[model samples]
Target: MDLEGLLGPQHPVAAAALISPAGVTVASRGADLDADFEIGSISKAVTGLLYADALERGEIRRESTLGELLPLGDVPAARVTLASLTQHRSGLPGLPRSARPLRRAIALWRHGTNPYGDNLEQLLTQARKVRVGRPRTRYSNFGFELLGHALAGAAGRSYGRLLHERVIDPLGLDHFYLPKAVDQLGPNALIGRNRRGEPRQPWTGEAIGPAGGIRSSVRGVARLVAALLDGSAAGIAALDPVAPFGKGARIGAGWITIEAEGRQITWHNGGTGGFRSWAGLDRDAGTGAVILSATSVSVDPFGLSLLTEHTRTVLNS
Candidate 1:
């Protein structure tokens, strides 16, 4: 597991680690265990943990509607249940259909402009104009962003405050943070990298935080995933797989269950202007891995391989 090879000419700034159920680091490479990286949609998984924690605390239930927690009055999304949103069955559009979304996407890819600058107030204002679709297993950043804030409301706390109280502090995730600005990411956070290998701005701000604004070190992710393997309440709840998401995947609260090397892999991946991330677990094997890279090149395929093929190969050898 030296991964001495990761220091190759083509490798981007990255950190990869394997962890055991007993909370031990088996191997790692690329960046130091403490280096921070923007974890993109994997932020949703953390939000899911908060959602589940709310459920366990009896503040909300599976049947709780967004209309109750949020003021999305009479809209299609308001009728959607907490479970539906968590499972990606809300049918909320991936991005709230706004003016010139295509142009905005172009700006995102071409210029690395932050797609999510609207704060909570602005986000709620935009939500009022959104159109919800049929309930299906469609991934929706809008759904999660709203859901995160809604849950925070239900618990009488801000989303960041709630997450820190219930998840980060409990897990001792010293480095996990929802930065309101790029400078707050601090100097230790890895510089983001776009496909063209240029530095990119931090994809942060309150509106985007719940859906994709988490920053964390490799050790933080490893510890969080390890807790999942050990039956932590939020961890177990996040993998309930309430609905079938796609051909080889089940839409658990926030995690995706897919097949790899004849094994079922529970995983989530994140991508931003200049970063990519992956977290996966082979529950039956009692093993999991976390991968983060500054370059936007996806770590999904390689992350799955390490959790499946790589682990299999190592076991056999």
Candidate 2:
């Protein structure tokens, strides 16, 4: 499954890194192993890990209600819980109606003055208007956004600060950060492009920072998967099959579950504007892979197949 030409003439820069459970990087691409990229929704996995860590430390309880933490005031869906948010069972709309308006505000802010502060408030107002769905499986970005806010409130710190203190700092993942502003990104950091090969301006993603704002490299993500495969003091753990929700499909905290070659595949994919990334771990074989690309093209099947094949080859050898 070759994806070298999938993006056509744009030729997106991509990096794939596979690692053993023992923390050895077995494969990689692009610059130094520690270089960073806009990792998109893979941030969800990190957020999940933070929640899990907080649960372990008794800083927050999974059963805690969102209303207790965020106090949605008059939002009818305030009954959501932390567990429901992480499991995508909250039923909130995937993207709020304010997304486009916020994006437009970000564009204008980039032109000269800052407009994202007002847009973020507008986004929160729009979010409160969202009606909850029946408790069921539906991918909702707003659910995670609420979780981020709730987690911050519970920890008594900002979301970015909490992430740094609990996850990145402990793991020694110096290259990863949730940028509060567009200028924080490195000049050489890869830019995302549309299907037509046009460069898209960087948008201030403050409104959805927790759901999809993380930036890291293939090597950094691979190291994270490595930690998950081998329980580390840094709080990473192997994928647990126990259904946190009812007896449904296997999903561990934040990572989705799939089966390949009779092995449990725990993985997540993320996309924002011009970037897409996928990361996974085969818990049965103690191997993991991370794929980062500078475009929004789907890379899941390719990343999964590569990880599965590579793990099989290495184990058989």
The TM-scores, one per candidate, come to 0.92, 0.85
Mind giving the per-residue lDDT tens digits that candidate 1 earns over 1-317? 54446323334578877866445553444456677889999999888888877877899998998889887667766787888888888878888766356777898877778777778887887677788788877888888998899899999989999888887888887478899877688557887878778778788889778889999988788888888888753647777666788786787778888878688888899998888889998888778888888888877777776677546744565
Pairs that collide in candidate 2 are none
Tens-place lDDT digits, model 2, residues 189-231: 6666655555555434565677877888666677677777777
Worst 10 residues of 2 by lDDT: 111-120
Candidate closest to the true structure, highest lDDT: 1
Give me candidate 1's TM-score against the actual structure: 0.92
Displacement of the residue 47 alpha carbon in candidate 1, Å: 1.5
As a TM-score, model 2 comes out at 0.85
**lDDT for position 163 in model 2:** 89
Which candidate gets the maximum TM-score versus the true structure? 1
Q: Which stretches of candidate 1 lie over 4 Å from their true place?
A: 2-10, 26-31, 233-235, 309-317
